[model samples]
Target: MTEYNTVLAPVLSAFWDQPNSWTLETYLKNGGYEGLKKAFAQKPEDLIQTIKDSGLRGRGGAGFPTGMKWGFLPPADGGPRYLVVNADESEPGTCKDIPLMMAAPQFLVEGVIITSYAIGSNHAFIYLRGEVVHVYRRLLRAVEEAYAAGYLGKNIQGTGFDLDVTVHAGAGAYICGEETALLDSLEGRRGQPRLKPPFPATAGLYARPTVVNNVESVASVPQIINRGADWFTSMGTERSSGNGLFSLSGHVTRPGQYEAPL
Candidate 1:
């Protein structure tokens, strides 16, 4: 048995017993918007720097730097840009985003807002796997709660930045997890991988500048913004810093999320 370090998840077990844990009221009481307050205090570029400093790498199969990805976009010039969250996490040995969405979905909402502000995008879309109906319902409920709580929708929390996030569940297909294939699925076509060289960051999803990232990658931003970069970079290896949730499955003593530094 070749064992590896399995890291724990943050919001997965954050609140077990509480009326409407997915509701805005519960998330607020549990120190949810505190990160937004901190995020709004800093300039957008500075927010990106904070994430870079945190050394928060992507949690999906790809360990790309979250901050650097956000910084790659050119300045908006009266054109539309989009943030596409790849919730279609169907890696053979992966199982994280669904549970996180089911347990504490507000963490994702916070991440979306902070990321939208940083990338100058007022609209975002989450492409979830269609096989899990329960998770889809839970995510829909979370979106409604965030909208009702003034964290989403027009003039967010008195800031001029406005964002609208939609949860899009894709038809069941494993190939859709590929960045270009997912984009094709999102655009209502057969799921197939498009040619690279023009990655999704450049021309993607209706021929606009789009950032397609994994669900866990999108959800990790709020904490990086709140804790500052130095605090985040303290863990992990030289190339891969920061703590992450690693899931060990099959015949294991305890098959759950465990936290470890790379």
Candidate 2:
């Protein structure tokens, strides 16, 4: 059997075992939200370029390059664009987001702030799987802590950028895992996938340009920003750089989450 230590690169899970690990203080002590600060220093377009250079990809099964996705959003029209996090971890073999949220939600919240700024969104939404009420509660508390720390509201960190994060519980429909269907469900409408031709990048939630990202995908932005793209690119393969959370379940000695470079 292979040693777990040799296979792991625990950036996202680095502080999961600390006492009161979810608190903003613990996060701050361990270098939390540093990415957002770095992100604020760059132009939104430049931020996107940095992520592009990092070679990070979506972990939500799509495996699409994240930077390219954000780049797809049209030039800002000064309207209400959004950064919707697809926290619906319903698909089989897809279980990293929930554990990440349960253990280190600050990563996601901070990532959301950075991503929203990069994509020119002042409003962001986390469409979480409703069944996991405990994780949902953790996320809410994390958001509140971020707000208290001046990371989510008006003039975050004195950067003059404002953002509001809303955590919405899904209706437990598997189809809602689809981006457009999730958007429809988010808008209080019947959950059904919307047609293409106007992709989410162009006409997403509220018919405005929106970027839908998975929890792990957004959770990665901070480390990339704080550590630099070259550092992120140093892990994983040439095509698929960075670490990923692999969920282990059933028939295993220690069934849980494992972070490995991919």
Candidate 3:
């Protein structure tokens, strides 16, 4: 017989079981905006460098390094550079993102703010699948609460950093989960993946430099900023770092979302 050591890490799922866990009040009580505050104290480039150092990868299937993707955007060309979050979780047996939104939307919202600030983006969007109307509504309300708390609008937290978040529900196409396809759908066009070379980073939404991240990927940003890179790198393997949500479904005795080190 062999014995294995197992540990559960609940960074994102820590408060899912709590009352009104989706509400801003609950999130604030649990040290929510601390990361945004910490982010404001540093330069945008430094924030990017911190993420690069943290070894955080995309949670949207590709596992690409998140910091490197953000760094791919060409030095600000004076035009608008956008940050679009791919919240359309349409892959088979994928149940992590929707649950995260339903339970702890503030995690995603706060992360969006930090990421937008880090990339010098004033406008960001959350592209959700239309099938999840309930989740869409939850996200809209979350954004509303964030705005009322002065976290989403101009001059956020009196730091002279401004951001606007728009939650757009897609037409429920599975193909839209692809980054470029999600971008096209976001532009009011039919969903389809675009050819590479001119990737989203250089020529993305509205043909400008953009950073497209997954729901879980963006949601994880706040914690990395709050806890520091070394803390994130401490978990998971040498190639893959930090904690991730594992979706367990289909005939399992204990089928549920599990958050643990990768």
In angstroms, the error of model 2 at 63 is 0.6
Q: On residues 1-262, what C-alpha lDDT tens digit does candidate 2 reach at each position?
A: 4687788998999989999888889899999988888888899999999999999999888899999999999987778899999998897866889889988899999999999999989999999988999999999999999898889899888889999999999979999999999999999999899999799999999999999999999999999999999999999999999999998887889888889899
Summarize candidate 3's per-residue lDDT along 148-194 as a digit string, tens digits.
Answer: 99998988989998899999999989899988999999999998999
* Candidate 1: 10-residue stretch with minimal lDDT: 4-13
- Candidate 1 residue-wise lDDT, 191-260, digit = tens: 9999886877778878888877777777778776776667667777778877666777999887876556
* Alpha-carbon RMSD, candidate 2: 1.3
TM-score of each: 0.91, 0.97, 0.97
**TM value for model 3:** 0.97
Q: Which portions of model 2 show Cα errors greater than 4 Å?
A: none
Which of the predicted structures, 1 or 3, would earn the higher TM-score when compared with the native? Answer: 3
Considering only N, C-alpha and C atoms within 3 Å, which residue pairs clash in candidate 3?
A: none
